[model samples]
Target: MKEKFNEAAFKERLEAQTSFPTLYPFKFIVPKKSLAELKALFPNRQLVFKDSSKGNYTSVSFQLMVPNSERILEVYRKAATVEGLIAL
Candidate 1:
């Protein structure tokens, strides 16, 4: 069975390393065709993309000033809806 997402553990880790309202960097690896969907998640932010050497996937990274753990968790939750997204 797939283990449920451990949001509490993730929040604890974030709290340890980051201050509130910090510029958090998010990264994801997704199939090339899903780039648009990933971009939709951060409409106003600039997303940096790096194509995999084989060109089947792309690595997307972006930095946004997140207000709190709730917001960060929210973004991840939304991203999880995308097909073949691997949160980094």
Candidate 2:
């Protein structure tokens, strides 16, 4: 027997555009303590948090609608210095 192809996943991959749309997911790691600060940093954006089992490290997953990647990078850079954050 032959394995079936994952057509849906392949289509999604092919359909991904070079330019970002109105909303997209940004996944990063941060310290548990700085989660509040991270939230404040993107007060206008919607956030979806996914907790990490690792000690002292919290996984943050959020979405940005029409965001500037430079601004996101700046936020990540600042978050990197928050004692225990390690962006994944």
Candidate 3:
């Protein structure tokens, strides 16, 4: 089962822990078929990818300098639209 996510609390935590305009890392595991879609979300950013042993999924990771927690949240919100994506 998926754990519940409290957006407000997450935003608060991010604000408390992070400084603005800093490099933030994002990682996700997604089905191979969804790779293109995920890549589209972060055009021009350098993304490191690793294929799963079975070759059905790939782990994608990257970092970007963001203005604030809201920017990070916005990327997550957009990434949520990609099917079978799991953020880590």
Q: Global CA lDDT of candidate 3, please?
A: 0.94
Candidates sorted by TM-score, best first:
3, 1, 2
Best by TM-score: 3
Local distance difference test, each candidate: 0.90, 0.62, 0.94
CA lDDT, candidate 3, residue 69: 94
Q: Write the per-residue lDDT of candidate 1 for residues 2-75, one digit (tens) a residue.
A: 78779999999999988999998999999998888988877988889999999999999988889998899988
Ranking by lDDT: 3, 1, 2
TM-score of each: 0.89, 0.52, 0.93
Who is ahead in lDDT, 2 or 3?
3
Better of 1 and 3 by lDDT: 3
| Candidate 1 lDDT (Cα, 0 to 1) | 0.90
lDDT of 2 by residue, 1-88 (tens): 9565454564456346435434646677777788787777667766777776765666777765644444444555665656555555
